[model samples]
Target chain A: MTVQQNVAQATPTINLPTINLQGNHACALGAVAAGCRFYAGYPITPSSEVAERLAKELPKVGGVFLQMEDEIASIAATLGASMGGVKAMTATSGPGFSLKQENLGYGMKAEIPCVVVNVMRGGPSTGMPTRPAQGDLMQARWGTHGDHPVVALTPGSVEEIYQQTARAFALSEKLRIPVIVLFDESLGHLEETITLPDVTEYENTIRKWATGKPEDYKPYKADADGVPPMARPGDGYRVHTTGLIVAEGGFPTQKADVVAPVMKRLLDKIEINNDLVESFEDIDCQDAEVVVVALGIVGRSAKKAVRELRQQGIKAGLFRPITLWPFPTKSFRALTKKAKYFVVAEMNAGQLILEIGAAKVDKQSVSGLNRYDGEPISPSLIKQAVKEVLGHE
Target chain B: MTTSNKKNLEMRFSGAGGQGLQLCAKIFSKALIGEGYHVSMSQSYEPTSRGGLSRADIVASGDTPDYPLTTELDVLLILDQAAVNASEGIIRDDATVIIDPRRTKNPPQGNFKVIALPLSETAIKLGSERITNVVATGVIAALSHDIPLDIVEGALKSISPKKFLALNMDALHAGVELARGLKTA
Candidate 1:
């Protein structure tokens, strides 16, 4: 279905009160609605508003909000909370995201279910704090180190930010992995009037809890879905969790034979359950000559540009991945089968385009429209690039 | 650059930082939301505590806009010269632009209608120069066909802090008078 139809179906027909909500604020609310009871974060630009809003909203719901000393401690605290059997989250920008990598890696290796929000900003260091950039597209998937299961979502609008933030928590809990929600500073700060979904209507997905004999339980043992039931803190199940590779007994082991299946199960969980983990939006791609691939704010710009191009009788389409990590390759190829040319428009200097090139089935002509000076890619820029690629006036 | 049939009205409240440009846009956004129109507000500013280019834009439509950011402006409010160049090449031909002559030395020169008003001067006369944003908000509300004066006043009343309610109301009224005077002349 088209993006417009998806939006129409998502909006409830009932008369719901609409309010102007910033994207960051929507994330905080979404987390609260998703039954996230613990938040640990260090405030940074573009992403600070998420913590700020949660500081006010969490207390009302009897949730714990922490202003940790640093980003590392922030993620560490968030992981600890989740291990204690609570849905937890922490938000940060580029510099802090770099600092939290080690703890984020720990969360991944230990299979701690938590949500990490990274509001993309211009960076290698503390580079342009207030400006927006998509430079972290590759880093988000690989920053935590090793061959680990990664789930990162990219939301384009404020409404999608809310929906995806909730989805991040659900996915993290269900799969027992750290789910990252990535959006640039532009979408983080943008406010729009939207009727938020009723929190009561959300079916919060709680993690599978350990049952039966406490002595017989093993922490790393996998079910048919490859996800092991987590032992609750007070449930008397003797559980051992660590950052090192471990066997089904949850004991650290370096023996290659024993570690092999343990590692494979960790990676196979996401791949086997791809149905629940993948989401994307395709707009007018059925009979198009050029298909533009983008996400986040750049995706919204491409959507507008594609609409304008179609008005001028240009057969242009847009394929936007709501789930950034894992790339949604299977669906992308299936949706854009007839397209001859592809353009990847992003705020950074060619990060996601690399994945697009690798994911394409044929040797279709692929080009990029990249802007890294911290300004967002506008619709006019995308339209001009599409025209140039198509050799049109 | 073709306009769609959708009533997508775009407006910008721009000036140097600490001028409450965001508050101006928020008040209008609240008013538009109350009128059953969907509003998308986005802002851009420097990383300083104060005194840099700051702008807040609002795009209102009957339905959620496909793109929320402002590409072509229908109305523009410039409180400082720092924000003048930011609107270049994007102002629509039939747009209404209001500027503070005391703060902006050279505004954009175009086919759009430019009304130079004493926005900051009016706020100074009231009490503080910080309320220049409120004054500008009033002028925009008065000149805009989509927003009514009473609804804008109600929004200002609801959003303004209790301590500054009376001053903000006075500033808003003075702004409406300035726009009305321009219309009469």
Candidate 2:
């Protein structure tokens, strides 16, 4: 609740006993604090520090850190570890994220709980490995093949990176699905001084495990929360998991009536628990004429630009979505109701802008300021873009 | 030459890869954090191992900055020509720029005070060229009033490898002497 309250305030809170910590290092520490016991990853630029720190830290906590052959094996081993009743995760950048898509999709269908971190970098394929970019916005949502559920959190600061990585584990365990922690390379590598939450006081969320008779156990069956209890390995329950559509009995099914409800439950679970999935930050959105929407580092830039614009008598505000996937549409609409125009600023060449356009209400104008040249969008650029949007009006 | 409030002060350490540019920023960050100032450090580099442009920037403030990356630099350290062009159009008019004349062919032409020091040469004379980053870190800390030399030395001792501690200390002191000479001249 303290972390959520800090994010809702949307201002950096400086507490005492602060240590200057890098974002990737914070994420690894966060995972350990969240009770993550297994890490399988191949080191990649921008995200390599996450694995590097985990390699050094995980063993101290009695966790297993594996250097896999490649990215695909990394996610597979992570999912396998989670299935063995351990909190597990794997981290990568763009190209490695591409290789893990198949196993990520498999984890989704099999209802395995795990965390996947993709520190965004410039890319169609290995594009500027060390440079920062937010080109993976849409890919994170639709990279896998099919209509699978996604819950991705984008934290904008080093402190938030630590908090959100822990939250990713909690959400994954609660929902029985893979959760992605998305942040740009700038945030991944940026170091800041802040107080981390005490690991002793932190509560770790454990996935629901099956307890009833093994004879009546159905691994694919949904409870009231639309999440079925997973059978722990070596339990007396007959559990079956596959990528194919399955019935409540946990066997493959092609019957329309059986497949329809199964698919519906898979997708509808996210919608049904939107309250748990939706999170965003609203800064000066009330009575504003223009709202700037961004995430990660661009969101931080927009925060500064919006404050400067307010001092200049411009009604500019920032609406940044910390929960990037599922887009947090309801809160975005509710918070920016007074805005007449919206500007979506991102490091990519217009991916999140499309989602913002789709979420707008009637008569609300939306524009985009896109950058894909491996440079971050600065505060001045966002201010200029907001002025241009207002100038046309 | 004068120490000011650490809030909102932007500093950059830039050069080719393998020059330990990020380490320079890390030392400053540790020193500042010890003084109770919040610091945010970010880096940019090419994919190569040792020859492309690399930079690490720090923004120190009373609280966490709204934007962490540098927009206007108060102090700039340039060790190679490859890093010169990347810093153009962003240096403050009153910024202090320290450059190695031996490595940089054409440094930026600006109103900022450009202090051309034999940074690399001084490190080589001390022991090895690899300690050039520690030497440059000392120059920036010595010139800036907000950072105390004792704190910087403490940070260096904590972060340096055990075998190189004495060499690094010598390089740091030589850098302080270089800046002291500039002030007296």
TM-score of every candidate: 0.96, 0.95
User: Each predicted complex: what DockQ?
Assistant: 0.79, 0.87
Tens digit of per-residue lDDT, candidate 2, span B1-185: 01445557899999999999999998898888888788999999888888889999989888878899999999999999999999998999999999999999899999998999999999998879999999998888889988999999999999999999999999999999999999899
Question: Tens digit of lDDT per residue, candidate 1, span A1-393?
Answer: 255322212335467667789999999998998899999999999899999999999999999999999999999999999999999999999999999988888988899999999999998799999999999999899997898889999998898898888888888988999999999999999998888765443335888999989989999998999999999989899988889898999899999999899999998999888888888888998788999999999998999999999999999999998988888898889878999999999988899999999999998999999999988898999999999998996
Candidate 2: the clashing residue pairs are B3-B145
Prediction 2 TM-score vs. true: 0.95
The A-chain TM-scores of all the candidates are 0.97, 0.95
Count of backbone clashes, every candidate in sequence: 0, 1
Q: What lDDT does candidate 1 reach at residue A279?
A: 85
Evaluate residue A131 in candidate 2 and report its C-alpha lDDT on the 0 to 100 scale.
Answer: 85
Model 2 has an lDDT value of: 0.89
Candidate 1, position A43, lDDT: 99
lDDT of each: 0.90, 0.89
Error of 1 at A140 (Å): 0.7
Model 1 clash pairs? none
